[model samples]
Target: MVKLIHTLADHGDDVNCCAFSSSLLATCSLDKTIRLYSLSDFSELPHSPLKFHTYAVHWCCFSPSGHLLASCSTDGTTVLWNMQNGQTLAVMEQPSGSPVRVCRFSPDSTCLVSGAADGTVVLWNTQSYKLHRCGSVKDGSLVACAFSPSGDLFVTGSSCGDLTVWDDKMRCLHSEKAHDLGITCCDFSSQPVSDGAQDLQFFRLASCGQDCQIKIWIVSFSHILGFELKYKSTLSGHCAPVLACAFSHDGQMLVSGSVDKSIIVYDANTENILHTLTQHTRYVTTCAFAPNTLLLATGSMDKTVNIWQFDTEALCQARGTEDQLEQFTEDWSEEDVSVWLCEQGLKDLVGIFKMNNIDGKELLNLTKESLADDLKIESLGLRSKVLRKIEELRTKVKSLSSGIPDEFICPITRELMKEPVIASDGYSYEKEAMENWIGKKKRTSPMTNLILPSVVLTPNRTLKMAIDRWLETHQK
Candidate 1:
């Protein structure tokens, strides 16, 4: 089951869209600013709000490289901001005649494209922010746009229910009706190549709309190497019109959110609904799936962003270690940190990261397995006060990493429980917090407030050991 892990509360107005990078998150709002947050713990990052848009910022998009953020606005400008320093790197200005509604990075991150109110899609170069090319949607008002996984085809949906395609050279390729009503959002699924059918090469395109339906299209290359989008199937469960849709990074699952205030997860392979979540109080406007893990984020008109997790041991193990943190820290330069470590006789700690490239925060995030996959550190110990200081830092990183394991977390406090104890019930909880419930407040179990048999809390030695071991192994 997908569970709510965190709720971020910052945006004052409606959050229109959210973009996920490997380690960071960006959310643009009607508050006229784009804010960045740490995906590790949903903590708001410092020096954010790449603010300058005159009106509500409609969408925030991360480049494929994850180092740049582009925020488009109703004011007809797309500002590309540097992810590290929150500085405006470049701005793509469009005619004041139209608001740039949607912008996306090409698969290569070398180019960015956006659809404006004028029914024109403009492509800009990343380096100079110059016009690389532009394509005009010849039919009706362009409501949504996206690039295929291969970057060979560009697709757009219009207010008149028309869908248009363009080749890499910006030539009009095809135009057709994709929905009975206007299309709101669209995404191309990551290819499922693991089945190893060499003859079967196609990606699924999931689009949601005002018609309260989701259409999965089989996008494939034609016999002449041309591209084509074939209608596959329709998914309907939302009682109200669908607003947004997103695919898991691996393209195995698809999730849709709607005005009905419900979110549905679908098995992309079988086209069946996996789970339906009714946690949002208002219309859901934005939804995103983290690229590296089984994490989903949904933002709604309720002024909140809900972070959900689809936890599985296999999914967690499949996530890759991020390689770049050279630009992550605030004060210390990447090379300077490495030099400081070596000069301070802490090269062994540097070796723990395996990769030579990392910053202070990234180094703190290294897991025990990443530090010593072969049990090389098993035989090693602090053996000194310096190493003991590093152990103290383990507590500090508890706030920076993704979060503590669910098992170690206290149910009531929703924080890591250092001193766990079992109550009359089978469930375990933090010693002091549980005591406050039974003794101070004279209440019963929080999970099930049944009459306490006897307010006697016993140490859960087994769980305590596991928590201690986790802390020890993560002591940097």
Candidate 2:
């Protein structure tokens, strides 16, 4: 459930974008100004209504640490502002002198990227506040951009319906047509999924466009294979063109706003709708999730920004009931198995299952031979039916373990390491495995494929502690 917490009707014209940091909220508009408010009280900051942009402001984003803010404008420049004082830190002019449409900061806050109407993308050094590198799309205006959580890659979407992926060095890695009409917005989820082989790491990317559809893609990266983007699924919930989409900080939920003047919140994993919001009176142009809260901020063409709070307690209760039934099949007792058998129309087998005390774990281990010999089932069809159900249970259990963190897996062994060590290349690896590789006179870094400067390895106590904590929590 969602509740309207507060509404800020301050902008005189259409609100172009809205962003939230841990403690503050920001909104920019066609009124040619940006506003800041404190999340604690929903009160406007005293030095707010920042007024440097000479034309309409198109987009605004806060740095990862919430210390600085970046806003782009039709004036052909993107300005970096000091969040504490609302003072301009730097003004970067687009090389093509075209109106800047979108801007984003890298996850580490070391780089700032801005996209312009002339199809040009500029990477800026956040420390020096100077241009670092530049690239361009082939056909249309660059409208959307997002950085992957690893900070090694980023993606840009253009009005020509193309999506381009680039590495941190500003080199194009891959390009493809993602939408038929035009791409408006895109985002990368922070959660990483382990590819079934455990050798690859995959992140989900959601892209929405003027084609009135949202597409999810699986973006994987490996040391040897580099990056690969594959189509995953499509979401067709909105009746009109979707304008904006954002993943929650946990990456479990996705919220999107559309020209239909509605917002749809979805369970990111299942692609199921959680709720739909229709409080906005005009086209909803932008939406964002707070860094560390259940609050959401949405901007609309009606010149207002609305803050919505989700009832997470209620949501958790509803999902908990469903999870108990669908997930953790290995924890079911004998009675639970009997009920499931009856539900599957195997009521006649319940007597046999109870006589043998077949619990969930034993049921999942039942093979054709076990069903025929141990259970003493005479019918071949009955054995096949039991085996098929067991196979289905095994498949579901494997999928539940797909969310293991990539950092926990050693790059060389492709498995969780008991002793993590940092090598000269600054990448962690299993200690014994890395020592064997180094002993073989192979003086190269497995991750970067570069020559190692020294043969020393240090214990990665911090990474080891993190892995330990994760295991303790998940194992429970």
Candidate 3:
């Protein structure tokens, strides 16, 4: 388990938002104050407390550049603060609303989107502090809103279980009833490479709600391509309703915190519960990952900020060759060899191998010799053993490879691979032919351009020789 380095107590009430700068942490609490602390020593800095909000500050977030911090409050106002001097840069107010539940800066930091209890989602231009676009949800309050990473789209989730997707112009492009209960939170993942028409897959939304469920949906242009319910898988061990959830930077892992005073980490793709963090004594209110580290900081009603660092090296080490083999077999058994003589027979054979009574080195040597001579054996002592081992490996490989289709295509380009190559074109080719073509087409011009770009030496051959000598020394 990882340990919290230090605890800095500054908030009198629950801390709702905690954001990290390069070396500082800024936290906003219901006490209507924003505190900045040095990350190195967890000591408070001598900055002015932001005192603009008349009510509790409910949400706060930092701009992508980390130079500005934005906070929203129940007083119906959002304030942007300068990180350098702790000065209030701008204050934008909503005409009518109960409170702003969430606010986010666009990836470009050009605009801000705020969601409020009045069911209104407003987009504000950062420069003018003027509302550029506004849209409404019908039945329930807008609980969460997020801008797509590319700035091409945005999505909002409401307490009525409705999820709405809007284009850059603030037009409703897609809307759907996504859950059984009120949608507590929603986020849009940067589009992923897929075998679909769009190069970017938009609205890979992960949502948690009062239904005690966490769900993932793949939304494209407002259409639902597919969705998976992971209530049991993601919130399995927790008995309370989930209150907060966030996807990791890579979008492969999700961390969810609940009112049950527990935080569960899930494999975003498989929806498998990875670990349950049980340090908070009260409801976990929010969680965020550091910009460039595996360190995760979570805040809760327990009046504490728990920082958890993922045990990446330990996870990798735990997944050794034996674990890999077992995983391979488990996947194979589920998808292949169902039409064989009998399931029981295959199970029995696998069970025997599980016992692993045979000498591994002897089996390997015998198998190699048998393969070399077209299954012929001169030594009777090892012949049967070699044949059995070879048969086992062949059976396993066959079962494993059968479920996978031939003509594996690139998920990005939607083209069959000719040869395996990672390209600057943002697509990976799996086939040799495609790779060869791409390489030949792109490699020629770069080499020719580089020759002229190289620096020239003095007119004499001595200078060239001297330059060559220097290069040789540096190369060593």
The 0-to-1 C-alpha lDDT of every candidate, in the order given, reads 0.73, 0.86, 0.62
Candidate with the larger TM-score of 1 and 3: 3
Model 1: residues >4 Å from true position, as ranges? 192-201, 313-476
In candidate 3, how many Å is residue 310 off? 2.7
Predicted structure 2: lDDT: 0.86
| Ranking according to lDDT, highest score first | 2, 1, 3
How well does each candidate superpose onto the true structure, as a TM-score?
0.64, 0.70, 0.65
Clash count in backbone of candidate 3:
7
The sequence of per-residue lDDT tens digits that candidate 2 reaches over residues 1-476 is 78999999999999999999999999999999999999999999999999999999999999999999999999999999999899999999998899999999999999999999999999999999999999998999999999998888899999999999999999999889899999999999998753323334578999999998888887766544466675656765688999999999999889899999999887786555677899999999999999889999999999999999989898787556435644667788898788667644476899999999998878877888888888899999877777766654454345445544645667787677789997877677899999999999999998668999998998865556656766776667
Q: Which of candidates 1 and 3 is the stronger one according to lDDT?
A: 1
Give candidate 3 regions above 4 Å deviation: 190-203, 222-235, 318-327, 331-476
- Candidate 3 lDDT score relative to the true structure: 0.62
Off by over 4 Å in 2: 195-200, 321-476
The collision pairs in model 2 are none
RMSD of each: 22.8, 11.5, 16.5
TM-score of 3: 0.65
Q: CA shift at 317, candidate 2, in angstroms?
A: 1.9
